[model samples]
Target: MKTIVQTPDAPAPIGPYSQAVKSGSTLYVSGQIAIDPASGELINDSIENETRQVMKNLGAILSEAGMNFSHVVKCSIFVTDMNNFAKVNAVYGEFFTSNPPARETVEVSALPKFVNVEISCIAIS
Candidate 1:
């Protein structure tokens, strides 16, 4: 059966969608931006900070599903500017020290809330 997952630690969905969905051992996490759930504020002061917040938001959703970075199999990262790739990668790397998940970073014209970065992942429990 499929199950929806939500958590207060992560920013609530801006639209009508759950933070994640679980089907069997796999958890599908939705794209996360830099919105801080505690204060509901956007953390876009810097690209690194924004990426950190996005990763934090993703982490919260994974935790809610009883999973972590190690369990992640793949991830999708979207950025408005390819120039910010290095900065974003640095912070994102902090989450996975070894055996990192397969991922692709794409440059786009825009993202929700016009943030510089957004990330989503798939994990197994």
Candidate 2:
């Protein structure tokens, strides 16, 4: 059976979807934008800040599932601009210093809220 994960520390889904879902020992986190959970404001002032918020959002979901970055096995990063890739990577790298999860970063046409970056991950406990 699968269990739905939710946490007040993460921004509420703008649509109809769970924050994350867990089956067996694996958890699949949904894509996270830079919306601050406390204020529902998009953190778009800079790529660094936006990516940081995205990671925090992802972290909140992982935490809710009793996991952390170390538990992450894979990650998908989406960005509207390739120019921001390095900036985003810098912030994302801060979370996974060693034995980082396998990941792919792609440039997309756009994202929800028109935010520059979005991230999702798969983690195992």
Candidate 3:
């Protein structure tokens, strides 16, 4: 069976989608931006800070589903500029220590809120 996951620790969905959905052993997280859950506002002005916030948001969702970064099997990262890839990767690496998930990073024409980075993940439980 499939289930939807929601948590106040992370930003609420901006549209019709749920924060995440679970099917059997895997959980599919929706794309997360840098919006803070408490204030419902963007968290940082710089790409590094914004990327950190995005990671934190994803962490919160993963925790809510009883999964951690180690359980993540894959990730998809979208960035406004490829130039910021290294900085984003640094912050992202802080979460996944070993056996990190397979990932793809791409430069997008634009992102919601024009944020520098956004990330979505898939985790197994």
Selected candidate, larger lDDT, 1 vs 3: 1
**What TM-score, over all chains together, does every model reach?**
0.98, 0.98, 0.97
Cα-lDDT of candidate 1: 0.96
- List lDDT for all candidates, in order: 0.96, 0.95, 0.94
Residue pairs with backbone atoms closer than 3 Å in model 2 (clashes): none
Residue 56 error for model 3, in Å? Answer: 0.6
lDDT of 1 at 4: 99
Task: Please report the TM-score between candidate 3 and the true structure.
Answer: 0.97
lDDT score at residue 56, model 2, on the 0-100 scale: 96
- Measured with C-alpha atoms, the lDDT of residue 61 in candidate 1 is 94
